[model samples]
Target: MTQPIPPQKIIVHQLGRDYKSATRIVDDILQDPKPGQIRLRNHFAGVNGLFDAMAMQGAIGYIPLTPPFDLGVEAVGLIDAVGEGVKMSVGDAVATTGLGGAYRHYQIIEAAKAYKIPTATPDYLAIVPTGISALVALEQVAMLQAGETVVITAAAGGLGHIWVQLAVNMGCRVIGIAGSDAKCEFVTSLGAERCINYKTNSVADVLGEHYKDAIDVAVDTVGGSIFDALIDNIAPLGRLVVSGYASEIVEGAKPVLAPRIYERLYWKGASVRGFMNALLSEHHRDAATRLFDMMHAGDLHISLDPTVFKGLQALPDAAHHMMSGQNIGKTVLDLRDGV
Candidate 1:
């Protein structure tokens, strides 16, 4: 009888600012699942740029990194083997999210961590935590209402795109913010009433002039000046959900002498909230279910970036493309190579 070949996976062997300096792709012996675990033949792995950077650089204290750690997050795949006492069987499709074991040809993971799905596809990667974060920030955190004026930053990207549609679905008027003319158009096409190109137009100027005291909810991913803009013009009783500071992820926070936050937030009864998806796991199952139903019912659109990065060897380039803020939508690595 022929023996099965080992699978391959990527790991961060050292702490470095760049992917090439920090990571190594190595062959992984495909081991059978332990009890209460499942072995998945990963079809696609989500490329999360911000998390990758933090892991690579040891930036965040909670996610402590030692040498040679598993280096990817969410993935969609098919179960090829299940361990003793496990319910998931061979050929069952699944999606798994948390951290690590995602950028591989196969993954042996805890059964509880894997969610059974109808099909193993890249679309699941887009909506699981990505869309769930948007949903949670909108509904649970922001308490968004229909007809509310909403602003979404980096609106043409993966997470931002989902919220734009979700807000529109809720009957909210959306003002999107992007980096370029084409991105602005893309955001508008996704149902945003308008998209401001920050490179061309001052975000603060635009919002202060037209949207001042009108934005009911602002979901901001790109921080820096854009965040200032959102806060400066927020309406009375408005809510701002800080989903990410993508702009500051790389450089760290720049020192800016600015007015106290309460000065802007105090009188209006407005507030700012930070959202970290992992810390809000209790809401995940419900959010995922809602998003999946929306997708299945044709009420949601999953946009995958056109640039293809196939195989484990392409991870560095893929991670860089996303971290550099170049991707149009969800950036995923196709793991079907030589499978």
Candidate 2:
């Protein structure tokens, strides 16, 4: 006779910042009903900006959680038990991402979307690609060509840094636009040929002289003013990739691109494309594996700096630190560290 599966302890965590009041509330959800999904003991989970935004808008309804909807989007865990049809073994290490509900000690995951973390690869590195979705979008969706001049705004960010390295490795001359000197240096360290601290440099003066004609591709990770600044500088036949806006969540803070910008783009024979990485499928991931291979070979370095947070209870503070851009690398809440 087959043995019955064992029950496991699971804790889900989340935080919501009120849209108007900006008050933050975090809670640990108990998912002990032992639902019909693969039970996993989470090892490391990383925070994301999208979760923070959703929290601010009070849009946590879509996410599946026990009581408090878990806010994390990606995590690495070990499979402890499986529901009826799951194929994973009891001790297999896997990483689940995208469908929300991470931040936990143990949780259930649908079978198909879970990825097995290779024995040689660390779980933290496996989680990197999932969180840097924008980088994947900029590289794959855009079909960025080599030897072109590419511009990336907010170049110091998690997604932006990967985009810079990916573009550079593709043989593109990258120009990074960052808010501070430290951010500029960060981009430069990632191999961006030119780093412009937008706060200090005149966009027009810098681009007109350096690029000569215009930027071949503009990967705008920062929306609002930075997006506005790139409109006139984009080259003829250039592709403008808008992937995110981290400017301000205070509502009406990030103004949409004006109609005139589209008109200008049309006149210049350029195209503006909006991308969401969630739309990428397994085939797209196969293509990105080439980039990842490069990363592993050191031809394109894309590892996140390890920032360890204490425990599940401290997720609120870590989330705030992430939102504030205080954490340099991926802030991983080590589930086993305290357990």
Cα-based lDDT for every prediction: 0.88, 0.64
How do the residues 74-177 of candidate 1 rate in per-residue lDDT, one tens digit apiece?
Answer: 89999999999998899999999866779888899999878788999899999877998889889888999999999999898889889999999999999999
* Positional deviation of residue 141's Cα in model 1 after best superposition, in angstroms: 1.5
| lDDT for each residue of candidate 2 in 1-339, tens digit (9 for 90 to 100) | 545333222223333343224332343343532344676777777666555565545554444334234356677778877777677777888777754446556677776666665541333443345434645576666668888889987677666777787788778999998777887888888888889988888876788787744788888866776766677778888888887666654353554545766677887888888876656664544644565566557665544546666556566666677666665545566666544
Total residue pair clashes for candidate 1 = 0
Error of 1 at 117 (Å): 1.7
RMSD of 2: 5.7
TM-score of 2: 0.79
* Error at 223, model 1, angstroms: 0.5
Per-candidate TM-score against the hidden true structure = 0.96, 0.79
Which sections of candidate 2 miss by over 4 Å?
1-37, 55-68, 119-135, 253-259, 282-284
The numbered model that scores best in lDDT is: 1
